[model samples]
Target chain A: MKFTNFLQISILLLTLTFLNYFIVYQKCPAVTYDDKTVIHQLSKQNVNEKIFFITPTYSRPVQEAELTRLSHTLLLVSNLRWIIVEDSDQKTLLITQFLQRISKMKIFENFEYTHLNVETPKSFKTSRRDPNWLKPRGVWQRNEALRWLRENTTEKGIVYFGDDDNTYDLRLFEEMRNTKKVSVFPVGLVGGLMVEKPLIENGKVIGFNSIWKPKRKFPIDMSGFAINSQLIHDKHDAYFSPYVPRGYQETHLLTQLIHSINELEPKADSCTKILVWHTRTEMPKLKKI
Target chain B: MKFTNFLQISILLLTLTFLNYFIVYQKCPAVTYDDKTVIHQLSKQNVNEKIFFITPTYSRPVQEAELTRLSHTLLLVSNLRWIIVEDSDQKTLLITQFLQRISKMKIFENFEYTHLNVETPKSFKTSRRDPNWLKPRGVWQRNEALRWLRENTTEKGIVYFGDDDNTYDLRLFEEMRNTKKVSVFPVGLVGGLMVEKPLIENGKVIGFNSIWKPKRKFPIDMSGFAINSQLIHDKHDAYFSPYVPRGYQETHLLTQLIHSINELEPKADSCTKILVWHTRTEMPKLKKI
Candidate 1:
């Protein structure tokens, strides 16, 4: 009777183990790849410096729609990795599933990405009714991406803050690719100006042409600049600040990373042509169910 | 001895049954709904007539992006059902999963949709090199939707052929909802015309303002017309022709459905406003992997 009991217990344990394995297998099937397939395609780029597009995003009604439009534009470029940091306590299954589906597409087969989530403190978070410009958002999320880059990346690359809602022209990526230290460009439809541009004199960025507040050292939007990876790595303590004033986020962060104003390299034909736009989609009126 | 054998077999059967049930339950969990939940929201609309938007789409690099944009616009309207027919041999998992996600959103909680796939014949399918106008597309897919509507839908409704690539203003849906018979409107940037419009005289469509072959009965694009569901059911065999001439698609189908121009109801403020655009997204330039 003792032998039979032991035998039944052993059989039950074996069955449970096999069942667990089968369930896991069904949930995540094996991904078959050819011999030439590079799992992380960003590490295999032949360029002198890769471009890391860091976008800090949050959950909203238009989150997936905005990402879909942006992904279509980004998929055209080469040697680029998208670092998407979400504003959530934990990584949501919706976003993870979306990123996985996009990554599997043939057009994005060579694309590389990293998904990170860092929740914003309740005090710093703004209400939905607040105007976007009045509230300083994406501060901690951007810092988290910068922190990840500093800890994981050692190779040469460029870091750019690409807001999900902004419209990007393909030529802007090419300009950032050749960035040596810090590149600046013209951003259209921003700061109540036709173009908030980097004022270039003698092929160097002297000042900014922003109409809102030209008093700051670097009066540019988030999409207006790109920093070299080496510079970011060298300046270990530089990151975006949440305590800064409404419009001082850009200036406050740039001052820490750059030793002098001369480090700013004007791009997009000496900041004469607008290659990017601060265009925002109008909120769709959804009827109450 | 026989009684013991029977007991052993019963135990084995029970164990197998429990394991199978556990595996199936793990694969697909249940979805809970409250009393206020709207399962088939399309059937709950108070409107006398529903609008069925039939869109024939194929898998492309920008398929999801285009569909997402279209969904944003369509979600704003009430009493509408989107019939997305895929031009493939079988329904793809990608399209099915995409529809499921979109339908679950709060903004689209009331949106209803049907997914169907009908493969284009090998001989008629055009290559990528061919210009869009040269190839007659969406012929069979539209027919499949019409057939489904005839067989499945018995209530009063309006059927409109909406292309996935076009841009629709919200006002267009309101105009289509009040369609009496075959509603005619102006489609902007179509057939190399600034606006292919219906020339109204005394609240009736007299002719077309189209520069591209105005001799035809209805010189408008696919997005410019909406037909009553009852008329389609009465015709019994009316559908788009795959063998029509390069520019005769709209005319060939309209002639079969409408006996005279008097039956057309001019909409969108007497067909003056260009509420929809025949806009297309340019193909992204991606490097070969």
Candidate 2:
């Protein structure tokens, strides 16, 4: 009887150990890439710094071309990961296939839409109309890119949301890489008033001169600023909200970030000259495609 | 031969006359409704005195409730038409059906969401998250609503973009109806920015006091003022733009219609105490709806 009891105890212990091993394995997240391979490549020689360029494209081809040109220029400074979020469900072959061929770029395509209904009358069709400012439409896709950076990136680098239609100077990314909280630059063709920017004092941002009414906070544009990955990782709520009034998109997101606008570092000669212009692409009349 | 030619000419003239009559019958635009037939029973005897309440709604149940309450209260006012524009694609059945049940108010529902997507990143999906201050989503929607008024409204009275979330006193409408070019008032919720109104001296509007920054125009909420229909009809571009940074939605739209700050008429005892608070609704989380 003693020998039988000893055998049963041994069996029980073995089963428990097997269960613990299984649980630990389940908790471990799978790595999508070979880390040692990436590490070896990094040690061998220096490639350009990696920049995740997120561009939102709707129905404009010219804007896409302009963005592609911007991407080529960015290639000079860093590895360009152009994640193009198209406003369609099924990826169009034109944009999707074109992006896939580009070296060192990850192309993601998807679509999203939201509408107001509780106050609309029966006779009007309100939900089907495309939103004006493209409120947080591609935000989740941006978060996806952030997730990719967190998981894939070993080297420190910069991330930016480049609107498909805007003009960019090559120097902007170098300026962005130096961001502490968020670096703001002047944007033209916005605010209906004039180019908007932050009033800098002693190499620190005092406040913004935005002509449009944003809620009390860092009232700036999504494109006009850049943030460090460390800041984004540290801050819990760094994403934009759709529910913010039409113009408060940028301000509301930045408000929850680091306290003190003084923490925001100003670049591009204290944001005097325009580094970015908030230009919009007119709807193209597509013919034969 | 001469008789045959004359007969052909006569036949051609007869055909041309009949074609003219048919074209006129088909091409003349249809008047959607004769006011006398549908809501003539609800019309007040007060002919010269009329009030028009215009409101823009995005997506908030509480704001909608406020609008519904306002619609119910407007039952007291004579000859009131509530123009509600939904900033969505298709009209929501819920909102449409609700408007259908309301009496003593002609609910004209329209939708446009053009200004919501300038620099928005493709993958951001920020529109899904709820934020405070549901300001005008589309500059063109207001323009479209005003254009509709120019084409449709034959009534004489006041016009205001009573945003769905604002708190309003019925007495405020009385002060607004007498406005010549524009009227100003104090708005709450803006921290220390206090009230924005035409600075008056000797019964003249000189300039405005907006404590906000960046926007070239005075900082004001959408619910801060009212305008005479004539001014809207007379102005060239009387609408908001996404191009305007955070706080300039009100200022830009107002500046287009009025020349100097002197043109703005002050109400609520020259904006002494806030009559209307720029209150916003809090998002309610439900475990199960």
Candidate 3:
């Protein structure tokens, strides 16, 4: 009876040892990078104000190329939630996989993203023969992002339209984070001018120096400004409309949100700095191989 | 005497308190991001195999745009040291400012880098009159990068030629990191083919599926393969030659380091996956203002 009891205990000990060593070695982690622990270990103690970056991307030759470049710039930003609205009937697998790639990295796991898509109507898309300014691009796509913001988030933060093709200086993000209302800054390489920005006098925006459409109410490029996210919820009807005449998309959206130019907050050292550029990629010509 | 001593003690305590809190707060960190501490805190516990990404970039209409996109892709990858060799007489401020922006980002502060520049002689540069394939691109710039590696790096790692204009999947970086001798993988949209790769016969690479030049021993895109850093040191005299006939750049340098096909290790699941693409950005058209 003593030998029998000893044998039973020995078997149980062996079983536990096997489970602890061999079995655990075979066990795979559900999360490979341990992203949460990494963030907890490395993230800043002070919580940062989140920024919603809205980009309306399309399926052109440079689509993936443009998005890939923009993703790098945004990854540097700590508390940004990217809203990429595709101009297609359904989200392309190409972009879906691209965002997944962005999310899985351990270093920038702190970066947040949202992928949404809304097709641009055929009527709104300009043909090759049409002038570059004939039709406003990314009209409905920007609206989709705003809709996503209203339905999904109640958090108060800044919302900036970050076109994928544009060049952004990291300082621009820092300058806009403390915005209480719409913040305006200069945009480089825009509208047949070296730079375009609102005229600031005594810490107030008096008007814009946009050469193309100087008479428009809010004469600015889509990349020129950022607004408070709460204003989106307050003014539910404001959005970029395709029906608006050429060069009025900025005005059409702004008039609905603010009554006067005094509400505009001048940033980037009172709009003396050009922290972003309204640049576009030249189309590559490829004959079918 | 007692009163004097008490006053002296109070002053000492006040000075210490100010130095610890207010003075420290006002003191700017010489390195604003504390890159070293950030890396020590957030870097992977297991040291990953380092990858030396060598890119040769030149001044073009779309120079910054291409580099910006590529930088984002590299930002996600861990344990990578980018060696950017500019095709210019001196390093430009545009690229210098760009690299500074990358270094200051907290999450990717762990990234290692070296920037060098060597001007491509005017004779080697392509003009509108020349065919795309008439002149070999990035010959001297790549050699400059190789020279930099030999001078600085003694560590064993993987060396790859990452052109600024190509598209890369993050997974490709992982597949090549474990290279013992050399690794070959499929490149998409290369050589006027849907994908280009070395054809495998039974677990070994017997030949390549290159339609452009089937006879060349190592018929591959510049983005197709990576070699061990030790090989670069072992074959110290082996360098890319400008005199090598068109489309023989890969073969010229590869033949010097590797003896036969047996030395090549197939990666990305036996070269079945297309993780990189040889896509080029179309030149953007901007009429002078």
Query: Could you tell me every candidate's TM-score relative to the true structure?
Result: 0.48, 0.38, 0.76
Between candidates 1 and 3, name the one with more favorable TM-score.
Answer: 3
CA-lDDT, candidates in order: 0.74, 0.54, 0.76
The best candidate by lDDT is 3
Off by over 4 Å in 2: A1-289, B1-49, B61-64, B104-126, B130-138, B191-198, B207-209
lDDT of 3 at B31: 11
lDDT of 1 by residue, A1-289 (tens): 3556646755775576577657644432222222232212222343457789999999865566567557656654566788999999999887897676545432222467899999999988888898776667999999999999999999789999998877676567777877888999998667766577887899987777676777877889889999999989999999889888888988988999886678998888988977676656544333332
TM-score of the second chain for every model:
0.82, 0.68, 0.83
Per-model DockQ: 0.04, 0.01, 0.10
lDDT of 2 by residue, A36-154 (tens): 22212222323244455776564433433344444433333334455566554446676654454333221111111111112112232224365655444555545555555565556
> A1-289, model 3: which lDDT tens digit per residue?
2555545645555455555444333221111222332223223322266789999888876676567667767765667899999989999999998897665442333567899999889888888778767888988989999999999999878899999878787667777877877889998767766678889999999998877878888998898989988899999989888788988998899999998888999998889987787766655444365
Give every prediction's interface RMSD: 14.1, 36.8, 16.2
Per-residue error for A260 in candidate 2, Å, reads 57
lDDT of 1: 0.74
Instruction: Candidate 3: give the clashing pairs.
Output: A69-B69, A282-B283, A282-B284, A283-B282, A284-B282
- Model with the higher TM-score, candidate 1 or 2: 1
How much lDDT does candidate 2 score? Answer: 0.54
**Clash count of each predicted structure:** 0, 58, 5
What local lDDT score does residue B39 receive in model 3, on the 0 to 100 scale?
27
lDDT of 2 by residue, B176-257 (tens): 7678878888765443443444466776655656545623665566777788888777874576675666667777888888
